[model samples]
Each structure stands twice: as structure tokens, then as C-alpha cells.
Target: AQRVTQPEKLLSVFKGAPVELKCNYSYSGSPELFWYVQYSRQRLQLLLRHISRESIKGFTADLNKGETSFHLKKPFAQEEDSAMYYCALSASSGSARQLTFGSGTQLTVLP
Candidate 1:
């Protein structure tokens, strides 16, 4: 079974400070890591994916296979960046892909 863990349930950082959301996963085969964010009243949306290797909204996450971790980082956190972030893992399951999500970390950017 694949599992995702976000060590911190709540994380806070001051505006313009660096922030990182820790994410760890356990899977047998090759897996894809993703970051999903949900604003106060908005639906959950994809923030970034390991496969993309791109930064979105000043956030970036690198998949570390050696450590089985994919931590989201941002150099300067903005107030608007405050949201609930979830780490997700995707792997092939039979004929389709299965997505497993973490409990999620709520990030609060203090003014």
C-alpha cells in the first residue's frame, strides 16, 4: 500500500520568509509526487507535480527518491499563499492510476 505523510499539520511563517512543507511517501514502484492546495473557499487544485519540474506561484518541490520525500518550498511566502496543502502520490493501479493523498498541512502566512 502507498502512503503519504505530512509531518506538520499546521505551519506558520511570516510574510517574505521562507517556508517549506514536508512530505514523505512510501511506495513500491515508481511513483509521481504532487502538491495540491486549497484556499479558504476554493476547491483543491494542483499546485505542482514532480514530473513537471516547474515552479508555480513561487513554490517548488523536488522529488528525492533516495529519501522518498517531496518537500514544497517557497523563498518568500505571501499572505495569499496561506492555504491547506496536500501531498499526493500517483501510481499505476491495474489499468488505471491511483492517487493517494496525505492528511495535509495548513500553512498560515502571518502579516
Candidate 2:
């Protein structure tokens, strides 16, 4: 089963606290991993991709093929970063954009 799992349903902390959004996956074929985030009433947007290796909004994700995991992390989570975070994986067969998503984790940053 190709699946993405986010263990934490919700995480809340102070504005300067570190944040980590765990993600795990199971897939038979080669997979591309990505993280998507939704802030307040905004649309879900791509936070980062394992392939990109770029950090967005102080967030970075590393893909571990052996462990089948891609976790999002930031040294200090910000209030604006508070949002719904989803771990996703996609295949080459369908649209590159067609991703299977996890339920998601809601991150709250308090002042």
C-alpha cells in the first residue's frame, strides 16, 4: 500500500519553539515526496519537495528512501507558519501533480 502517515494530528507551541511534522510512506515504485501547507483561509500550497532541497518559510524536508520517510522541520516555528500541513507522494504514471495525501497535521504557534 502506498500510503503517507502523519502521526501528529495537532501540534501547538510558542512562536519561537521548534517544529517538526513527521511523515512516513509506503510505496512499491519510486515515489516523489512533497509537503503542502494551508494557512488560515488560504489555499494549500507546496511547502517543499524532497527533490528541490529548498527551504521555504524556514521549513525543510528530507527524503529517506530506506526508511520511507520525509519529515518537515524548522528551527523555530512562526505564527504565520501555523497551518494545516500535509505530507504527500506522487507517481510518474499520472499527472505529476496527482498526489496521495495524509490526513494532515494542524500546527499552532502561540505568542
Candidate 3:
């Protein structure tokens, strides 16, 4: 079984401060990992992927295979960056793609 874990349910950060949202995963084989974010009143969208190696909206997450972690980070938090973030894992299971999501983390950037 594949599982994703987000340790914190909610994280509050001051504007201009650095932020990190913890995420961990367990899987038997190679897995595709992604971060999805939802802003207030906006639909959920893909933030970044472990394979993409791109930064979106000043947020980046590096997949650590050794620790089985993909923690999202931003150098400076902004009020506009406040949103709910989810860590998801996808892998082929018995000729079908299976996606497992972690409990989302709600980030609140206070100005």
C-alpha cells in the first residue's frame, strides 16, 4: 500500500517569513509525487511535481528518496500564498494508476 502523510493540519506564518510544510510517504516502488494547492475560493491546482524541477509561485519541494519525504518550502510567505496544500503519490498498481493523498495542510499567512 502507498500512503502519504502530512504531519501538520494547520500552519501559520507571518508575511515575509519562511515556510515549510512537512510531507512523508511510504511506497514499495518508485512513485510519482506532486503538490497540489487550493487558494481561497479557487479550485485546486497542481503546484509542483518531483519530476518537474520547477518552482511555481515561489514554492518548491525536493523529493528526498532516502527519507521518503517531499516537504514544500517558500523563502518568503505572503498573505496571498495562504492556501490548503496536499501531498499526493501516484503509482502503477496491477496495471492501473493509483493515487493516494495525504491529509491536507492549511497554511495561513498572516500579514
lDDT tens string, model 3, 1-111?
889999999999999999999999999898888899999999988899888889999999999999999999999999999899999998863344657999999999999
lDDT for model 2:
0.90
lDDT tens per residue, model 1, 1-111:
999999999999999999999999999998988899999999999999988899999999999999999999999999999999999999863334768999999999999
List the candidate 1 regions with Cα displacement exceeding 4 Å: 93-96
Better of 1 and 3 by TM-score: 1
lDDT (C-alpha) at residue 107 in model 1:
100
Model 3, stretches more than 4 Å misplaced?
93-96
The stretch of ten residues in a row with the least summed lDDT in candidate 3 is: 90-99
lDDT of 1 at 102: 98
Prediction 1 global C-alpha lDDT? 0.95
Clash pairs, candidate 3, are: none
Best by TM-score: 1
Clashing pairs in 2: none
Error of 3 at 83 (Å): 0.6
Candidate maximizing lDDT: 1
Q: Candidates sorted by lDDT, descending order?
A: 1, 3, 2
Listed per model in order, the count of residue pairs whose N, CA or C atoms clash below 3 Å is 0, 0, 0
lDDT at residue 69 of model 1 (Cα atoms)? 99
